[model samples]
Target chain A: MALKLYLDRMSQPSRAILTFCKVNGIEFEEVKIELAKLQNYSPEYAEVNPMKQVPAIVHGEFKLFESHAILIYLASAFSGVADHWYPADLQKRAKIHSVLDWHHSNLRRGSATYIFNTTIALAFGQPLNLEAAAEGEKILIASLAKIESFWLQDDGPFLLGNSQPSIADLSMACEVMQLEVVDTKDRDRILGPRKRILKWVEDTKNATAPYFEEIHSIIYPAKEKLQKLKTMAAKKEPQSTGEPA
Target chain B: MALKLYLDRMSQPSRAILTFCKVNGIEFEEVKIELAKLQNYSPEYAEVNPMKQVPAIVHGEFKLFESHAILIYLASAFSGVADHWYPADLQKRAKIHSVLDWHHSNLRRGSATYIFNTTIALAFGQPLNLEAAAEGEKILIASLAKIESFWLQDDGPFLLGNSQPSIADLSMACEVMQLEVVDTKDRDRILGPRKRILKWVEDTKNATAPYFEEIHSIIYPAKEKLQKLKTMAAKKEPQSTGEPA
Candidate 1:
């Protein structure tokens, strides 16, 4: 039986897994669990994943949740895929695991908050919380700063200096790219200082190319909607009295 | 040169790694990083792990951080350790990874918050934030409830039906055990209803035995201190009015 993958493209990890499968030519049936509709709560889906989060998989009799875990499992189960994605060299792989594990508490935290509070809210027509957005911006910036100072400072472009992107690169770059949906000014202010990180993001997208674009295409509609909301909101605001103020 | 591990017993992940090392008979030099003393910020330690977190390791020229990553590295690098701890069986290992990754955002969040706000604050003579403690307790209780309903429903004693404890068992048990330092009522309220989870906790401790106790010994003093504070506070409170006013 072909592997069964449960995903929702709105999630960063979900997109990462979809892109990974496409890039590696892994055969799987995609089951979309739309978060917007809360379809993940359905009983049938709960049996497959009690956690009801996306990027879960069923391979033969095996079941797995957590996108990174799924990624590791896929790399191990399939032959003929590039080893750099999850290297066999113990130290190199350990380095990748380090980034993957660290990601949940760091980059993932900031990116999700920044996107949800800013872009997702706008797309849904929910009032934006400026206070929360500012806090999220701080976290996002600090996280980016850490990546620039530590992970990206290694020789060459990718994390751990590999010429090709690893699962860590795919996972983290997807996380950082969520900043694209944030208001342009807010996004630039948060991501602008990290020069190496910006370059790495472009490098990863270019390397992953068609698959990355294909998986990420789902977000474009939401992004455009958010942009339109911003334009509308800006027009509704009172004009500033430049001289008096 | 021996593998060097930097850790502090007060941190749950640090204790998990320490216990894993002891159980697996992995030879290493323990370098204590006293978090309470702010030693992790020192330049010397920062060179070892730029993230400045405990439970980092250096083997020969290779360096790794993040406790889960370190756990996976140690399991692979050391030969003859029990397979069930980090099983070579793909399905079994994937289940373990699922728990480990899920832990950081869920169980770890609640337990860490509960400890820091209630016990750690009392130990440091800082005022306890009742509001935050309540929120933490809610998260902790919800996380425990999920574990009981899903993960612990297996027929066997351990997670995923393994007779032996895996790294996930060690990591999660250590996290949940942080409730020991919380105020008696708060701890009871959070952990009391989960009978199966309590038994499993005992089972994991017994399976891992001396190492679990030995690694967790550091928390005893803090636990005792918190107990005294609770008792003293109880005595200082005004006697309840005999008649309903």
Candidate 2:
């Protein structure tokens, strides 16, 4: 049976996994679980991943969630995946693991929190949380700075300074891509100061080519729809203010 | 050179790594990084782990951090480590990785955040964040329920239902140990209903024996000290109440 990848491209991790599959030419069937429609909570989807998160996989009888794990599994199990994605050398692999693990509490947390507070929350009929957004921004910037000074300190374009991109590069780059859905000003403010991060993200996208751009193209339209909603909400606010108290 | 393990037993991940080393009889030199003293922020510690987190390892000049990554590295690189701790079978290893990765954003986040807000925050001279603690508690319970129903669904004693403990079992059990430092009432309320979680933790502790208790012995004294401080603070409250406004 072909591997089943349950995903929604709107999710950062989902996009990373999708791009990885495309880049490696891994044969799989895509099962879409739309987060916006709350399909992730459906009973059928729950069987594939009780966690109800995207980027889960079912290879025959084996079921796996958590994108990092899925990525590692794909890299290790599939003979086609290049070694640089998850090197065989114990030391090199360990360093990549370090980056992947550090990502969870730091980069992934910051990006997801900030994007949800600023944009996605509105789609869910929730008000934007400025305080939480500010906190998320703080961590996000610090994470970017670390990527610049530490992870990218060497000469190579990719994270950990490898000539070729690894799962860490793809995962972190896709996370940074989430900033695109937020206000342009906010996104620029976060990315503008960090030259190395900006370049590395572009490098990662390039390394993973047309598929990377193709998968990520969903974010632009989503951003436009969100902006239109915000504008409509702003226009309605004045009418509410004029109503009799 | 012996593997250099930089850790602070007070940190759950640190203790996890420390216990793993002891259980496998992996030779190592323990270097303490006292979090309470803010030694993690020192330049010297940064040289060991640029991220400045505990449970980092320097094995023959190849430095690695993130406890999960370190545990994975130790298991793979050391011939002395047992196979069941990290099976060579592709599917088995993938499932273990899933548990380890799922742990970061769920169990570890919930346990760490709750403990920090309720107990550790006071030690850092910060008042209790009741709001954050409540939020953390909700996630912690949900995470525990998932662990009970999903990961421990099978007949085995440890997580993922393997008879022998794996790195996932140790890492998660250590994380749950953080709840030990919180108030007894709070800890019991959170854990009392979850019979599987309680038993599994004990099973993991027993599986990883003498060293598990030796390393984790620190938490009891730490818990006692926190309780004493709470009692003193409560006693002083009435005196403040009697003072003139």
Candidate 3:
């Protein structure tokens, strides 16, 4: 039986996994969820993933969530890939693992917050705060700097210096691509300070060319929604009930 | 060379990794850091891990973080243990991966809030609010319920139902043990009557055999300090603050 993937193009991990399958010639059924409306909230999807998050997979009787896991599973189980995506070497694999783990709390959180504050909060009719926005951006920049200087630089054109993409490279590129959707002009400016990183992201995009097709349509709607979100956010500064931390 | 671990036991992942090493009879160095004292904030530690989180390992200069990644790396690299710990079979491995990913947002955040609110808040003399306390309990029970009904069902005493525990069981057991330190005896009222859940928790602890040692000594002080933190909580209630979540 073929694998079943539950995804939304706007979701970074989903795009990454879809692209991986497409590029590798792996067979899977793609089920789309309307992330904008939180269609993931429906009872149907909930049975598959209790967390109601995207980038989940159902393979036969088994189920799995978390894009990183799904990425590894696809690469390992399918035929058209190389071992470099998730290396067999112990320490090398550990390095890849470390970055993926760090990516979750650091860059991944930053990307989600920036886009959500810029986009989803508007769709949800929630408020966004500039102070919080500025704070998140600061985190985003520091994190991006680490990705560039610490991991990608030593490897040359790709993360882990593959000259080919690894799961870390693929997973992260999808996240950085969220920033791309926010506003390519602003995205490059943010990425501008990191010379090698800016180049590496471009490299990852080309390597995962199939993603360009899956992701393009989602960009315009996302940006328009995000603009409306900005106005709603300006209106929201006063209602925060959180105690001063 | 023996494997070396750099950990702060205050962090549950570190404890989980340590427990895995001990259970496997893996000889390794235990290099401790005092998280309460803010020792991880040092610039030097930042060199090893840019994010500066604990439970990182330095095995012959192949430093790694992200407990799940470390778990897989150790299980794969060492090859000393049963395949069930991180099965070569894709389905079993995927199940473990799913739980590890779940652990990130679920265990990491919930446990941190509980431990921080009750212990760190006490140590720092910050206020802990009722709303926050309830929130923490909500997260813990929610996470525990998922572990019990989903992973620890009849066919399996362990996550995979083996003669011995797998890495999945150990990773989760570490977080569950945190309940001893930050266990809210009163949570049964707020999260609603989960008699089956409460009973399941006891069954889980009993099945594990060596439960208290998993959580003792470290949280004992934190538990002792909760009372004074309550006094601090009362004073700060006007402003809203208190012990660990």
Sort every candidate by DockQ, greatest first. 2, 1, 3
CA lDDT, candidate 1, residue B32: 91
For model 2 chain B, the run of ten residues with the poorest summed lDDT? B236-245
lDDT tens digits, residue span A23-47, model 2: 9999999999999889999999989
Model 2 pairs whose backbones collide: none
Over the stretch A181-232, how does candidate 1's per-residue lDDT look in tens digits? Answer: 7767877877787789989988998898888877777766777777898778
Which stretches of model 3 miss by more than 4 angstroms?
Answer: A129-135, A181-192, A213-217, A228-245, B42-47, B122-141, B159-164, B183-215, B225-245
- Among these predictions, the greatest TM-score belongs to 2
TM-score, candidate number 3: 0.84
Candidate that would win on lDDT: 2
Model 3 chain A: ten consecutive residues of lowest lDDT: A236-245
Location of the lowest summed lDDT over 10 successive residues in candidate 1 chain A: A236-245
Q: At residue B194, give the lDDT of candidate 2.
A: 91
Model 1: residues with Cα > 4 Å off, grouped in runs: A121-131, A227-245, B122-127, B226-245
**Candidate 2 Cα outliers beyond 4 Å, as residue runs:** A235-245, B233-245
Q: Which RMSD does model 2 reach against the true structure?
A: 3.8
lDDT of 2: 0.87
On a 0 to 100 scale, what is the lDDT of residue B231 in model 1? Answer: 67
DockQ of the candidate models in sequence: 0.67, 0.80, 0.52
C-alpha TM-score for every candidate: 0.90, 0.95, 0.84
Candidate 1 chain B minimal-lDDT segment of 10 residues: B236-245
- The digit string of per-residue lDDT tens for model 3 on A138-200 reads 778888888766777564588756667788888888788777655566676787677787678
